[model samples]
Target chain A: MAEKLLEIKGLKTWFKTDDGVVRAVDGVDLHIDRGETLGVVGESGCGKTVTARSVLKLIDMPPGRFEAGEILWKGRDLIPVPAQEMDKIRAREIAIIFQEPMTSLNPVYTVGDQIAEVLRQHDKLSRKQAIAGAVEMLRLVNIPNPGKRVHDYPHQFSGGMRQRVMIAMAMSCKPQLLIADEPTTALDVTIQAQILELMQEMKDKLGMSIMLITHAMGVVAETCQRVVVMYAGKVVEEAPVEALFGNPRHPYTQGLIRSIPRVDRAAAQKERLEAIPGSVPSLLNPPVGCRFAARCKFAMDVCVKAMPPLKEVGPGHRVACVL
Target chain B: MSEPLLSVRNLKKHFAVSGGVFAREVDRVHAVDGVSFDIGKGETLGLVGESGCGKSTTGRCILRLIEPSSGEVWFQGADVTRLGPDAMRALRRDMQIIFQDPYASLNPRLTVGAIVGEALQIHGLAKSRKALEERVLELLETVGLQADHMGRFPHEFSGGQRQRIGIARALAVDPKLVICDEPVSALDVSIQAQVINLLEDLQEKFGLTYLFIAHDLSVVEHISTRIAVMYLGRVVEIAGSRDLYDTPLHPYSEALLSAVPIPDPTVKRKRIMLQGDVPNPIRPPSGCHFHTRCPIAKPDCSQRSPELVEKRPGHWVACHYRG
Candidate 1:
């Protein structure tokens, strides 16, 4: 078995909102193997982002808190780790990249300066050395004329280029794990391809695990070795990428995969996409039963009576449905 | 084969980016430049491209929502570009648009019934209050929303529900052509399929034609009978959905299609990585707008422009080297 780099067990990251206690990442259990790419797939409000944020303890306190579970970074629970310790672990051992590049990057500073700042923070390099390191990082991400473009501001680069800059910054410290929250969601298809390829190249070169959180199954299929499907702040299904796509036991997983209109003859011939009806339940006042039961075609009396437990069906394939 | 319901000739829309001492037209962003296409009665034409490719601009231009700087828009034997405000108002009854952002499109202050009914009121389609309320309820039900939702505000509903409300409003005018501008793009993946499938069902039931504008190729492929690939304010290729997917004519189209990651893990596709970011629309590449990033571009590709010429019986391409 591959060595576990990061293990998250029964994580319950909830937010005390004005409405009520929002169970954003309610009882989630997942892990990332060393040098493995794991995809966390779900729609909005499914808690994929919350789960990722919980891993880094990035969720703001008072409003947000980890109610339960352990974020095991190499078997060491990071829950009790001090703020200063987390600051060290963040860019040095584990790093994160958000969906929107523009928001994630500081606009006032140059791309090179921002990257060098990260290096200076974690690696503790001199200003001159860090600047040189920033240029080298830019080159790794395939930015043309990196030396000159290093002086350019975030706004100076296009969306794709900005994303590349973001990637360079993320990879600068050479973290063992990278948490990408829909890294390419804000990009075009061509640019997304470039970014995904660059990510793959970076992972290969640096030998790092990636926890890629995205809603698009095409992206999951293309990059992830194993996949976890989330619904209404809970894990609905988990499996190896091929097994999950080939034999999706969970009704919700099946609905998601079937709904995506593939660019091929076989998919085009299908009369219509099998859209999962109804909407995701509000986390603040979530349903008493299975979160997906309302929209599930395979829901039974028992499914609505109680939330089902995750049960193993096949090798490395687990589903949280009664069926 | 017959008189197209809509025919656009050399449509162009430019926005002046002014700065410096005087707010003169320092530079013009060529948003939609020299684009032409024909949509036969009830035919769905998919317009697809990246962020600055002007697919949305082209859709808006068809309805004269964003006035074209230069173009001829012929619909049912009349020139839409030449029509006065009153004439245009009358014509708008036949042309409706579904906006991308559901949250922004629907009036938060207004009730769902009021929002949907406003169109019928504007066009003076409803005979009485009772009739209008009944019709609004019927429209609500048609898009899979309960009649009880009619009295609620836009904020009360989810993104998918709000989108349905938007759809119901668009259908109120009894439009013959609907410009669906990334209607499902804002919704979640599972919800997106619902909207895409809903659009198709509505198209069939109402005999409505659609100019579906989106950046997602797969979603566009599922709905559009014919697809037009765009790049930097120009349509590089147009073909039947299957033809475009199976054997793309233009180098750009081929690259664009290849870039899409197929969902199935077993099917290993050779993704053609596009070299760089989309060039600035303010000062687009001189000849072939795509020449800057195109892998197969030649010297002549920069010196002269390529006309969109018919390559096959029904297929068209704008490339110097393509057959």
Candidate 2:
């Protein structure tokens, strides 16, 4: 059996807004195998980003709080770790890249300096050695003329190149796991393809596990080995990528798969897209039972009375619906 | 047969790039470089490209939102480019646009009722105060918004609700041709389906024509009868959506279609990724704009430009090779 890389059990993350407590991530559980890619699929405010953030302790603590959960990394609990220890784990074991490279990167600093800083802080390398390491990292990401381009500022690089620099900095410390939150959402299709290909190459070379958070199902189908579907701050379905697309059991998951029109399919044959009615449930006052019951076509009285538990419907495929 | 509803001939929009101490115009960014297309009555034409490919610019030019450097825009057998301000304002009543970001596009201070009814007031569609309020209520209901949402501010609504309000406002003036610029790109997956269905329903009810401009090929393919692929500042190929996706003609179109990540994990695509970034529009590749990054470029590709020509009956391609 493959070694378990990370395991999240019954995680509940909440935020105290002026209106009420926003249950951003409620009772979510997932696991990733060693050297495998796990795709977290959800729309805006579905708690996918918050769930990834909680794994790294990246959520702001003033209003954000972890209610109950266990984030087990190689059988060790990460939720209660001290900040000092967590910092080391963040730099050496897991690194994250964000969607908007322009806002994430500091405009004042040169790309080389930013990358070198990561190496110096994590590995405690000398300044001269760290500079050389930054150049090598840039080259690994396939940036042309890395030596000269390394000194350029963030504004000097284009959107795609800036994202490559972000990838280089994230991989500088040789982390065991990488969390990419909408890493290619803001990129052009061509640039997105290049970045995804580069990440695939780097993953094979380094033998690291990846947690890809995105709303695009196409991306998940192309890159992920396993998939987790979230709706209204809860996990609705989890399965292997092929099984999820081939035979989606959950109603919400089925709706999402049907909604995305395929470029390879003829649209005229279908009268219109199969759309789920209504909108996502509000986090402040989420529905009493199934969060998707308001928009689901297969809702029942039982679904409105109690929240469903994740049960294995097939081998390695789980769904959280009563039906 | 009758003439097409909209015919754009040789449309070009060049933005001047300024530099140095004096900020003098040193060069021009050829945004929409001499593009032409025709859309029949009640047909949806999709303009697709990466960022900076000028798809949005072409949409804006037809509405006269941005003045084109040189072009002939014939709408309903009238030359829109030659119209005076008063005549242009009248033409605008029959043409409307939906922006990408609903949060930024809407007025924060105004109530939903006023936002949607403002267009009716401008065009003097309402006959009386009570009639105007009734019309606003009717428009809200048409867009799937409840009557209670009239007094709510923009911030009080969700992203999907805000977009419905935008659609209602566009429909208030009874426009014949609507330009949807990435309407669902900012929406969640399920919410995107709802909005798309709403657009389709409204179109059927009103017998409307649409110019759908988007980067996602799947969404574009779903809504468009015909698709035009753009690169840099020129259209490389145009054909029926199914034909274009099944067997693309131009090299650039083939690369673009192959880059779309499909939603099925079992299907492996033969991705033909172009090398290098899109060249700067101020000084695009001397002849063929995509030559710098074309995977199968010939020596003559850099010496002469290819004219857009019909290869198959209804398919058009601008390339020296393949087509």
Candidate 3:
């Protein structure tokens, strides 16, 4: 296997509120190989986004705290890195494309200026050089009329176009690892495909790894090689994309896959949709043992008694369930 | 089929946009234009489109939530388009709408019971205070919510729970037709299935017809018996769910279908990457509105507008390149 670009081990993130402590991300472990795409799939409040933010140390710290974790990026421990050093890593080594483009990009700055700012910060390039590089990055993402669009503000662009600009900004510094947190969730399907294709192309051209966090299993199937399924606040399952889709070890994964309506499946006259019975457990005071035990149809007494650790079910396939 | 439940013809909604201090109508946003469709009794029709495509506007227009500039909205042999305010208010009992954002739709100041019971009070369904309380509990239970939750406010519940309350409010009047306007789009993926199943169950139990409007095609396919594809305020294609997905005759439909990523990795789908953003609704491309970004557009596509024609049984498409 190629060298791992990013490795996360025993990561835990928690948010303390007046009501109680919310374990947003609890004990998530994964690795992203160089030039590979790893998908993190989960419903809202499953800690998927939190896990991504934790990797980047983007969480606000007074109420939100990183309990324990080792985030190894290119053999360096990101967790123990100094704040100033981490800032360097964030700008030069790791970049994130947030879910909402409208809020992510500064409205006051032109798209070109935003991208140029990143280049200027990391590479210490001149304004002219940075602007040229920004235009190049825009063109690299397949944005048409890049020269003209670079001068346009975020609002001047459409939702899809703004997303493209975000991607361009994220890639301006040419980071080794890109964290795309639900980048296409807000986009329409047609435009989503375009954005996904652009990301895939950028991955190939830039030789950058990606940690894509999204709820859409279809996006995982299309772009990712490895998959991690999260429920409530823990990693329920992790496997190769093909293996996970073909034989979902976790019941939650099975329900998610079955819920997605496919054209081929519709043609086969499948009337019974495999919907999970109950809603996701509340993050504040999530159930002990299995977080999904409340909703899991196959859950047993062991599932309720004690939390199941991710046990290796097969080679490279791990599931955290007591079935 | 026993006089379709609802029929819409040549529906058009135009919003005036002011330019400057002159306050002149610089442009009219053609939110919905020349759209027509019919829903069979007790059958769900999914209106699938991207943002700014007018699917939601069409739903709002049918309910007279927003007045249409020109169109005919006929419901059960009555021309509802010409109905006066009092007549429309009376007709509202038969037509209800479940908004997209559960958080925004429900009033924060009101409790769940009052929110659900308000509809009943409006239509005079409940005679007294006791009857209203009983009816509110019944509505909550019908939508899979607890009777005790009636006392809680919208913020007290999760996204799925709030949506259930929204559904309860919509069903309070015993509506014949419900317009579910992207009701599940704002929900978590796992919770989405639960809500969808709830909607399907309610539809069956109440013999209700749904005009389901959403940008997500997969969700629409799961619930809708028939599907209509809209683009730039026009109905590009309409057909049975199976037929539309199996063999989409319209180029736009084909592109939209191709854009949906299949969850199965074994099945390789050719993603049709539509270039450019959705054309400005205010100045949509002349003739065929989709010609600007359509992958299979011909020269005549710009000069001649194509009318929706039935190419096969129960399948209608509007395109110049059908041959």
Candidate 4:
């Protein structure tokens, strides 16, 4: 119904490792609508980051390859796009922010210089105008006394402030889509709240779609309108945020939701959290059929015998598990 | 608290920052300033705060891993801070720690068995090689690792598996009080649950006391019988887990609780977000350290610090207002 901004269909990005092929992003299908926040959630090795990185063509060519599937941006497939063309597409049409703000930023450069560089390259603005625009961007991100703070180096800012500067740089080009990969993972709970709030404000102000890649279920529940649960390089479940949390279809999804201990429930006697048994199967030479079958309590003989296709289970809800 | 198993009084750890040509002490980061608490026998006291709040520092001070600038650490009726080298070494047998990053904490050169058994050898808990091997295998199995994993290196295991190894090593000492410093923070959601359950099981089985330090409120609440909220190296509030969540007496605690991203989307929340990042610890706020960001801060809040007072039965808060 709503206009699609970014659509990833059955995309498989694998890395050629010595141990074997690492099926990082195998058979993943997900999409982001205009002005919507789509949360991609999974554990550390679930390929959520790889999928996000693949969209920007950021992976190393020698070791990584898009073995199968299509990435559609505004009805145009991006897999065939030239390297040089992708450079233009990046930061201008779609920008990204990484988890570690301390490393991603250039410590030597001033905050203003970093932000202005993005504007000058993409917007092609004059040096004076770009510097002025940088201050304005800093103010937009709620950095106090932007005019003075903009001239400060990355080290001058705290972890939370550095993340704000990163956001300002990413939004400088006014990209249609913004991809944040664990942007608040390194931050404290209070600071995380500030950053998440700033992101929502920025998104609403710019009318841009955000692909928030995070492992925190609470973060997804608060910020995302829709969610895609990834497991072992596959989209285990996809649904609206309400549907995903209210009635999780996939066993993996249910396990993840239940894994989070609740404060309200903590009033009662401490109960053992229903933790999912077993670790994620190795991405290298992944198991045949459903990757989650080994850990799934409801897994049947048929589940391990044949790969289950992602099927629509309910209205606007899709699941990869046969059950 | 009936002679708590461990009691800390006026604990303070200040890290000096050097600068200029001669590297003079420019300033000091008041990491843990005047923090006091007691952990009863077999009780879990969850220490919670933001990144710079010094929860980890407090834990380390208790174990003498990081020497405190000033404090009295009384464990098992003896002052740990005043103990001699041999006495402290002996005390270490009752106070073991599990670090946050499992990858860095475990020795890479040592095999799993060697690493877990090292504690046994140091404490002289095992009589012979045969007994040591038997104990190591039992500890490994208790933490849900296979006997075959004993020969493998730290790199051979995943994050979850590595964490289990770290836990096994901690338990090898048979410590009466285990300081878990963000033990589950590095693991995935599902694995985090598994580890939490394991810790609880081990706690009950061995009658172990824990000082759980983490940034996540929900996890702390779920695991802890009592929770202490810290801000700017000071304990702002301490209460029963349910009381702290249900009726936070301090403004900082209220804001901190509200900031936690609730996993249920259906539960609409009103987040009381504080402005600006955590102030520099080297030059923390003069009075109430949180007054700068406190929404209800008064003139007196900036001029004088508020003493933590019991606002309700078993609930302590340090705010000038609220209760």
lDDT of every predicted structure (CA atoms): 0.91, 0.91, 0.89, 0.93
Q: Tens digit of lDDT per residue, candidate 4, span A1-323? A: 99999999989999998888999999999999999999999998899999999999899987999999999999999999998888889958999999999999998999899999999989779988999999999999999999999899999999999999999999999999999999999998889999999999999999999999999999999999999999999998999999999999999999999988987564434777989999999999788989999999999999888779889988889999888
Model 3 TM-score on a 0 to 1 scale: 0.97
TM-score of chain B of each: 0.98, 0.98, 0.98, 0.98
Q: What is the lDDT of residue A129 in candidate 1?
A: 94
* Cα error, candidate 3, residue B17 (Å): 0.5
DockQ winner, 2 or 4: 4
Evaluate residue A294 in candidate 4 and report its C-alpha lDDT on the 0 to 100 scale.
Answer: 94
Writing each residue's lDDT as its tens digit, candidate 2 over A1-113 gives 68998999999999999999999999999999999999999888899999999999999996999999999999999999999999899888998999999999999999999
Which stretch of 10 consecutive residues in model 3 chain A shows the poorest summed lDDT? A263-272
The TM-score values for the models, in the order shown, are: 0.98, 0.98, 0.97, 0.98
lDDT of 3 at A263: 64
**Candidate 3 off by > 4 Å:** A267-270
Candidate 1 local distance difference test against the native: 0.91
Q: After superposition, how far is residue B62 of candidate 2 from its true place, in Å?
A: 1.3
Give every collision pair in model 1.
none
lDDT of 2 at B140: 96
Report how far residue B301 has shifted in candidate 1, in Å. 1.4
Which runs of model 2 end up more than 4 angstroms from their true locations? A267-269
Candidates 2 and 4 compared by lDDT, better number: 4
